[model samples]
Target: MNRSDATLFSGGHKGAEAEFGKLAEKFGINEVNFTFEGHDIERKVGLKILSPDELKKGDVSMDIVSARMGRNFSKVDTIRKVIQSIFHMVNSGYQVFVVGWILPDNTVKGGTGWGVELARLFNRPVFVYEQDRKAWFSWIDNTWVEVTPIISHKTFAGTGTRNLSEDAKNALEALFERSFSES
Candidate 1:
């Protein structure tokens, strides 16, 4: 069997979770391993099912880590933990996909979103697919950024010129073609 691991990074608190679920279906991933805090009663009971160390290791073989969101980003240690987790997953040979969802209109406060920022800082390729283009662009600023699932002509600076919706399919096709031709 041919299999490659992929990690999907998203905010744990909001729409990103739903987006992650959809992406999982698109990517054919059934269950994804993630860290869940046990602050709540239900979560605590669930956490009891496995040891903390085992949880850190992962629930199953080849199941790379997935982060939904972070509570705080001010501390360097918190950011480092996330980076370290991601680095470990990638080192395990999983392709990282950073997904960012739009924040609510009133809560557009800066600083809350860091999953994509951490991914970029670590020089990982980001696969950005969002519901609202304008809002997402406002969050990630497209001036000099390159993201996957390229859905907009304004964001498609690659070889082909096509509608944004076709960008993801086109890009994947190009990659397969290049790889096959090279071999």
Candidate 2:
């Protein structure tokens, strides 16, 4: 199979890479890059990336944006830099997979969270913590949705290294496959 042009926009943690690795293997994906973890004030701010379809959906990719920018622009100026990077990816025809880690407490707020909201705002598919199995789910919904009752195995175990509980793995695989497959 030909290598797919894909990038995993992770929250930046240890276990998250496991899942990313699995995704890479499943689809022969290229490029696994992490998002920014610092809150610098000198970065530019705006929508991260713009998809070709975005011209019709009026959506923008915020996959590389800083969530803190919405709250910390008062102190940090890194928003534009983050957003611009995201824009560069989208405009360049690369599909960005926004990933969020599931917290042990059944929450999506920890470990560099961004996927759901970013996907929603950008009108792109998202991979999030599977509420029941600790695996990740693709957000194909029109609006942002968060899963509850987080599973531990999928969230803590990096992808490709362990069993991903059939359902969870399937969901993630389907999203990635469908995104790049030509109809």
For this target, which candidate reaches the highest TM-score against the unseen true structure?
2
Instruction: For candidate 2, write residues 4-101 as lDDT tens digits.
Output: 43444322223434455556556555433323435222212211233334322422334333342232221233434333333333333222343444
Write down the lDDT that model 1 would get.
0.31
Q: Which runs of model 2 end up more than 4 angstroms from their true locations?
A: 7-12, 22-27, 35-107, 133-183
**Could you say which candidate leads in lDDT?**
2
lDDT values, one for every candidate = 0.31, 0.38
Candidate 1 TM-score, true structure as reference:
0.37
lDDT of 1 by residue, 45-88 (tens): 11122234544553221212222332333344333343333333
Worst 10 residues of 2 by lDDT: 152-161
lDDT, model 2: 0.38
Quote model 2's TM-score.
0.38
Candidate 1 — worst ten consecutive residues by lDDT sum? 153-162
